[model samples]
Target: MHHLVQSSLMRKKSMASSLPKIIRHRELHGEARQLNRMTCRVRLDQLECPYLVEISGVKRLLDITRECIFIGLSNDSRYAVGLLYSFSDSHHSSSMGHDEDEAELNVIVFELSATLLRPVKILIFCYIFYTFFLYIY
Candidate 1:
């Protein structure tokens, strides 16, 4: 039992030492992007969109006001979620509209699970949109 523990400790030390250290945020982000690109086959560039579609019983629009922001990893890093501010405009108008300024904060969660047996590379899990309204006084 003592020998087994010692061997396991040695293996852990070796493994820890073999891993490369990332000291900068850019480096870490780059590494993560690279890993995501290689494993998911979808580049991070594609995520920057001004709008997204919510598919339920009826299709809805999630209008993004700004660039999509990467939140972090989820499900033990098997997935990643992004945050974006969007608005729903049910009405179409030619001039400046009242709904144009309305926006909602939403989190877009996507699956990053990649496997040889699985046919799909990436799948959108869900979009959690917060209804809290922000009004300027």
Candidate 2:
């Protein structure tokens, strides 16, 4: 019984040491609460049409004109919002362009709320493409 207890304690300590350490910290200045409320709804208006993304309760229409997506709000069509998609690391290479091997997808969301300009929000989505495609097809 003494040997079994000693071995169990040793095994528990080894297992705990192998686990990664997680750091938990609270957001300062109520920024986390503000970020949580900052939600956008995206919908495809029509086939081959621009995407309608409702950001902060405002309806903004976005179109994929070139490599990046653009949005025009209100009468000021000249000052359009742009959404750029870039890889986290440009040097990262992947086989078959799978998300598992690739880095996180960074989406730069630019929008104009009210009269003042808002800060750009960078949304990072880590997609597991292998599991997604496997079940889909």
Candidate 3:
């Protein structure tokens, strides 16, 4: 009976940790990008603007890609969610001065391959238009 209780407690602990992992931010340093030609993967729901998505490093390069900013409307219709990229510049020393010394840091870019559901398409469309307004205004 004691062993049964202990197992049940253990099971409960595991169940409590099943929430989706949220990535608050990510950083990549020099040579880290070259270490592997990685891709970022994102999954979002079409109907819900601001659908939650995940980005991870991949090993291959592909044509389909996502922009740095992702915008969407919440189901409640009262709020919006924006997935944005923050840029950072890192400097390394070299004899080359000014232009030659400059090292460009590319944005965290990713490609899309699989088909997105209708809801996901709507979310992306809203995101694009929202971004457009921000730029225009």
What 10-residue stretch in candidate 2 is worst by lDDT? 18-27
Residues 1-137, candidate 3: write the lDDT tens digits.
Answer: 99999999987544433112111111122111111221224344422222244322223321122433434333222223334332222331222222322333222222221332112221221111112344554
lDDT of 1 by residue, 1-137 (tens): 99999999987544432112211222356433123222233345434333336532235444332445767654244456666554545563214343444555555665443321111122333333446888999
Off by over 4 Å in 3: 20-47, 51-83, 86-137
The best candidate by lDDT is: 1
Instruction: Flag clash pairs in model 2.
Output: none
TM-score for each of the candidates = 0.34, 0.25, 0.22
Lowest summed lDDT window (length 10), candidate 3:
18-27
Error of 1 at 15 (Å): 9.4
Cα distance off (Å), candidate 2, residue 106: 3.2
Cα deviation at 115, candidate 2, in Å, is: 15
lDDT of 3 at 71: 48
Which candidate, 2 or 3, would have the higher lDDT against the true structure? 2
lDDT at residue 72 of model 2 (Cα atoms)? 37
Error of 3 at 90 (Å): 25
